[model samples]
Target: MVTVLIVDDHPSFRTSARRVLEDAGYQVIGEAHDGQSALAAARVLRPAVILLDVQLPDLDGFEVALQLTADEDAPAVVLTSSREGNEFGGLVAASRARGFLPKDEVSGPALAALLR
Candidate 1:
């Protein structure tokens, strides 16, 4: 199973996402509520993928993705948001993330496809 770190500001969403991914057989290794915490968690866990929220407390998800991908052994980043895909416009493409997913659509299978 792939390991993942879920980063989001909402406590309830994190709980829901963890349950969803876990049910689909992915191991949720850790979770962070903001970009700085996400970076710290990523360094320690070295998960295969990071389910990151677009809007964060400390830094935007794109900025976080950029920093994470700068590392030689960075994991795949799958950006997420409560807003629609078109809402972010070109910003998502500009990031180093593998893909973007609206929060409601996020799932283990969807994330797995992004990794592929």
Candidate 2:
């Protein structure tokens, strides 16, 4: 099973995402409520992928993705947001994230497909 770290400021979304991913056969190692914690968790947990929220309290997902993907062997990042990807105005396409998934479309299959 692929290991994943979920990053989002909303507790409800994190909980829901954990359940959805776990049901879809993904191993959820940890969750972070902010970008700082997400970065710290990534360093320690070193999950295979990170489901990062686009609008974080500390640093935006793009900033976090840049730092995360800077390292060799960095985990794949899949950006997520309640808003549509086009709303970001090419920011999502330009990010180091592997891909973008809208919040409502966050399924195990969708995430796995993005990683592939």
Candidate 3:
């Protein structure tokens, strides 16, 4: 099973993401509300993938992605957010994320497919 870490501030989104990923056969290893905690969790858990929200309160997702990807054992990072348009897409490209998933477009099966 693929291990995953979810980092998002909104309670509802976080809960929904966990349920969706878990139902799709991925192991929901950890959840973090801010970039700081996400980094800590990543270090401890070493998940196979990280679903990160771009508008995190503590730190932006791009910065988190940079740090995480810089790590020797970095996991694949998929940036997710409600924001849509070229601006966000440009940032995702610049950050070198494995992929960017629009919050509205993500479902259990879609997320599972992205992981594969």
Candidate 4:
């Protein structure tokens, strides 16, 4: 099964997203409320992909993506937001994320296809 680390500042969103992805066949390995915690958890769990929220309290998702992808063993990153993907503009492309997913549409197949 594909393993995942989900990063979102909203507790409710994290819980719901976990349920959604798990039901869709992804193993959710860990959850983080901020960029620092997400990065720390990723280092330990080494999930195959990270579903990261675009807006975060500590550090925004783009910055997190930049740091995450710099790792030699970097996990595939899929950024998310309630906003449309184009709203992030060039930052998404520059961040090296696999793609963006609207927060409401996140799922195992969506993430898997993006990673592919």
Worst 10 residues of 2 by lDDT: 89-98
Q: Which pairs of residues clash in candidate 4, taking residues 3 or more apart in a chain or in different chains? A: none
* Residue ranges of candidate 1 with Cα displaced over 4 Å: none
Q: In candidate 2, which residue ranges exceed 4 Å CA deviation?
A: none
lDDT by residue for model 4 (48-115), tens: 99999989898878998998889777899999999999997898888889999999988778877898
Total residue pair clashes for candidate 1: 0
Please report, in order, the local distance difference test score of every candidate based on alpha carbons: 0.91, 0.94, 0.85, 0.91
Which number leads on lDDT?
2
Over 1-116, each residue of candidate 1 has an lDDT whose tens digit, in order, gives: 88989999999999999999999999999999998999899999999989999899889788899998888788989899999978988999999889998999988788778889
Candidate 1: C-alpha RMSD to true structure equals 0.9
Give me the displacement of residue 115 in model 1, in angstroms: 1.4
Worst 10 residues of 3 by lDDT: 83-92
Q: Model 1 compared with the native: what TM-score?
A: 0.96
Pairs clashing in candidate 3? none
**1-116: candidate 3 lDDT, tens digit per residue:** 98999999998998888888788788899999999999999999999999999898989889999998996668989889897735664778888668888887766677767667
- Say what the RMSD of model 4 is: 0.9
lDDT of 2 by residue, 1-116 (tens): 89999999999999999999999999999999999999999999999999999899989779999998898899999999999999999898888889999998999999989988
In model 4, the worst 10-residue window by lDDT is: 104-113
Find the candidate with the highest TM-score and give its number.
2
